[model samples]
Target: MKKLILSLTLAASVVASPALSQTVRIGTEGAYAPYNYVNDNGELAGYEIDLGNAMCAEAKLTCEFVTNEWDSIIPNLIAGNYDMIMAGMSITEDRKKTIAFSDEYYPAEPSRFMATAGAKFDFTALKGLKIGVQGATMHAAYAEENLAAGNTILSFETFDQAVADLAAGNIDLFLADGDPLNNVAEASKGAMVAVGEGIRIGDGMAVGLRQKDTDLAATLNKALTSLKKKGVVDKLIKVYFKDGPFYSN
Candidate 1:
């Protein structure tokens, strides 16, 4: 009787152990569509969400999606708010100082300017124009470093707001990733148009992990490589982007 009781207790402990719980928390900004967004059903959905789920499955991890603001995504990651970030975040040397990134899953794409239809403007020769960009992003950084001298660069908490300002004529132009900008243009029904060629920015997109979480980073890297080999990543990209500019190299 004593032996049976001990065996039952051990079994229960195993069932309750953390090792048996393989949940991986994935963080993302649910506002960037084609990458991540809240759908009509009020559920998180997009290419990154699909890719994250696939990677987690390939890595034998149970993933739970968590929505976070873009500005605080990195800080929250460092604070243990989530185990990984799959919010279309680009990998860059500056970000590398604080967080590690998985191997590039999405190839580096270009950024472009969008303005009201029939508005002729030179992106290279900007002067006395109000440009909008999402705060704390590469677009904002590029605008500040390259365009702020002669132009008015406005920062917003979300890309949607920046695009809204552009549509409302509050801003002269808005800069953002080609894929999302293309989506905005298509949805705008000729209300907006791309102003210039895609401007290449930053390294490719990848999963972000804490600097100290080397093991998790390695696991994600391996899984991403496997997914790439299996053509799962390419398939998802095609499904979302089709003949779009964003693609895997």
Candidate 2:
């Protein structure tokens, strides 16, 4: 009888092993609010977190969230530290060469410049100005390629730090996605304001996967398409953004 019970337990364990091993680990930067952030309760929370869970449900894969710094997010994924990234990372040609991207989950929100309230400058000729941007991002690339002629491009590890420098007058201008800048402007209470017209930057934001993981990328792309078709992505965007610049009507 004991042998029979042991055999049954072993069979159940064998049957459950694959389910346990099927978890898809997702990487994100817990610093970008509205998209992804560490909430007041110290848990990961935001649109991407909610959206990623939905995608996992649609894909029928168990999902695990892993917080990583923005600079290392891609390198860690390439190193097999996580199965995918859903960190509001934009899909760009340069990045596409290094990693695979799912179909855009979010539309291409425009990039904008934020400066201390009452600051002024020539957007056309920003030479000799100090511009802050988060390193390794499309914003950084844009600033370097277009705005770096005679400007001091200060690259920080996170957007919040760049905003901090802007607040302190340490930098002349800060360039970043409009979502975070909107959040900062509201929180700053007139300390900062969007300076110029939004600059169209990259394609859009999507899931980042290792180049060789085409199968996983396809799975994510299909799931994202379903989410878009079902209007779940739009609903989630409304829940977080609520008529904010990143959300369309």
Model 1 lDDT-worst window of ten: 240-249
Candidate 1 regions off by >4 Å?
Answer: 1-17, 244-249
Q: Please, what are the lDDT tens digits per residue for candidate 1 over residues 141-235?
A: 88898999988999999989998899999998899988899899999999998888888878899899998889988888899888888889889
**Best model number under TM-score:** 2
Most accurate candidate by lDDT:
2
Clashing residue pairs in candidate 2 are: none
Write the residue-wise lDDT of candidate 2 on 1-249 in tens digits.
999999999999989978775878999999999899999999999999999999999988889999999999999999999999999899999999999998888888889999999988888778789999999999999999998889999999988899888898999999999988988999989989998889999988989999999898888889988888887988998898887333335
After superposition, candidate 2 runs with Cα above 4 Å error? 1-21, 244-249
